[model samples]
Target: MMEKMNQDGALETEKSLKRNNVVRERRISGAVAPGAGAVFRSVHAMQSTLALGSSFESDHIWKLGCLDGSSPDTGKGKSQFKSSSITNKVCHGFHLVEGQSGHDMEDYHVAEYRKTKAHVLGLFAIFDGHLGDRVPTYLKDNLFNNILEEPSFWEDPKTAIKNAYRSTDKLILEKSMQLGPGGSTAVTAIVIDGKDLWVANVGDSRAVICRGGVADQLTVDHEPHSERRRIEKQGGFVTTLPGDVPRVNGQLAVARAFGDENLKAHLSSEPDVRQIRIDSSTQFVILASDGLWKVMNNQEAVDMVKHIKDPQAAAKRLTTEALARKSKDDISCIVIRFG
Candidate 1:
């Protein structure tokens, strides 16, 4: 049965401020392969320097970034690597968390959290790799910097988001001959200026928010099943015989992704961005990968965490529940409790 909120379950959880940050790196290094473009310079350092949701208000922000993720292996199948000093900072609130385990030895992770202003701003990101883990690792290290440094960031968050996704995807592909089959999926959420939020997704990872304890999925699952209607509308063919999860183009499960040179002609990495302003009705938020949603629905996740009264514990509980359900993919999650 699909997951959902139990009728009698009334979650009333309230957490003041609990933020977790994770950062690690990939040992695989030595400049972009052989002919990759001049490694895009670091654009923006993680801005833990700003107090986005601190003394000025009652908000909090936290994030977790995984440098080495579970993307596909490299050309020789020797895991991709990165310079020890390259920054691989990823993930943050906007209520979201992603963790990686069982990956090869070359990867690392890092995270940060802060509270300032009258509201909370959370940053959450997930980088799923392919061909080799290096591309995703590079994305984990530089995606945000690309976003923050974009000229449109402050003026037009949505356009900035679209631009960042394209620019980053192009950079990865342009350098792929050197990196070899280099690519990854990126999903990000920014809870800005306090009550407003912006979500951008490339690939299957997702972003879901809670309002008055009810979950409102902000990002769409870019899966074959989810896109069947649109796919048909676009003159694409799909077998709906229903056996196991739906597949796009008879291979991948997601309708879009980053750096799938083979799929780029048909698939897309361009993000679907959304801007939402918060009010008193807002409650909390959850951001996670397909591993979590594959086994649980938005409302079910919200229902379980709502009454917990502890954001961190609730986040873990959600992960555990997904595991028990036997989700095949690596699972990661983050929860942001609001005032």
Candidate 2:
């Protein structure tokens, strides 16, 4: 009888041990479950953060916008527009590349098509800034609007452009504290009905048109050296160091620019305007900042991208070529094609 009791006791002990083991395993699993869930949640949150970062980069880095209720492609610094007129069939594209200057891109551009009651206007511009991007950003946002707002825009676009540029500079100078103590070089092109092209510029940003398979520069580069007489007449001296370009008062490089509050007395915000009739001989027009012009001439840039059928590809090719040529300034380019 004692042997049978011992056997029963042993069986009960084994059952208790099994039950205890099961309870312990359940507790361990319960403890690990929350930890595993927390780890999973952390990984998911990290992925979400990474995605948000990518979106932020895309939206902020290449912030191209169209004022005519159209959205710009935020993938890269590229934009394009086509005219609505069947007879004209004008198209344009632009590309921008940030330089290796160790600063944020100080170049801004505008390439948009606006429809009015009578005509479709293609407006394009480049604002190359110094010291800061605030001035250029303001120009990109407000310059064309100010130009179109002028009452004499339709009757006399040149005077209208000049007045608008002057007034805009005044406004910028008036708000210099808010816009920062910086300045910008501007080149603006307005194409009306795809036939009449009005180009204006201040400073070194240039506009070149290809006609009869040759490049015809339509705008003048307002260099400090060339305009030294005027700059000195305005109480600013042009200085040229041994290995540096000419600068006004040993500071700003361009003789004529917009929004140089400290140097406004020495600078001229007046733009040189030219109006050209787009004809069969006219092939394309290129508007670019000095970054491209510093390395490539008007004819060379024209020849390099003349064969490119797509304007976007042409603009990209020009900027890519500028980078390949070791241009270390922010490069911005716009190409308008008229067939």
TM-scores of the models, in the given order?
A: 0.63, 0.77
Worst 10-residue lDDT window for candidate 2 reads 40-49
Tell me the whole-model lDDT of each prediction, alpha carbons only. Answer: 0.52, 0.71
Best by lDDT: 2
Which residues of candidate 2, in runs, are more than 4 Å off? 1-86
Can you write out model 2's per-residue Cα lDDT over 237-281, one digit (the tens) per residue?
Answer: 998999888888888888899987888989999999999988888
Where is model 1 more than 4 Å wrong at Cα?
1-121, 225-242
Please, what are the lDDT tens digits per residue for candidate 1 over residues 1-339? 111111211111211212232211111111112112222221111111112223332222222222233211110001122323222212222112222332321111212222222222344466555445566667777777788779877779888888888888888778776545545556676755445668788666777888887788888767777767766665554554566556556656677777766556556777899887766666666766676787888899999878765454566677667766765444556555555
What's the number of clashes in each of the models? 43, 0
Best by TM-score: 2
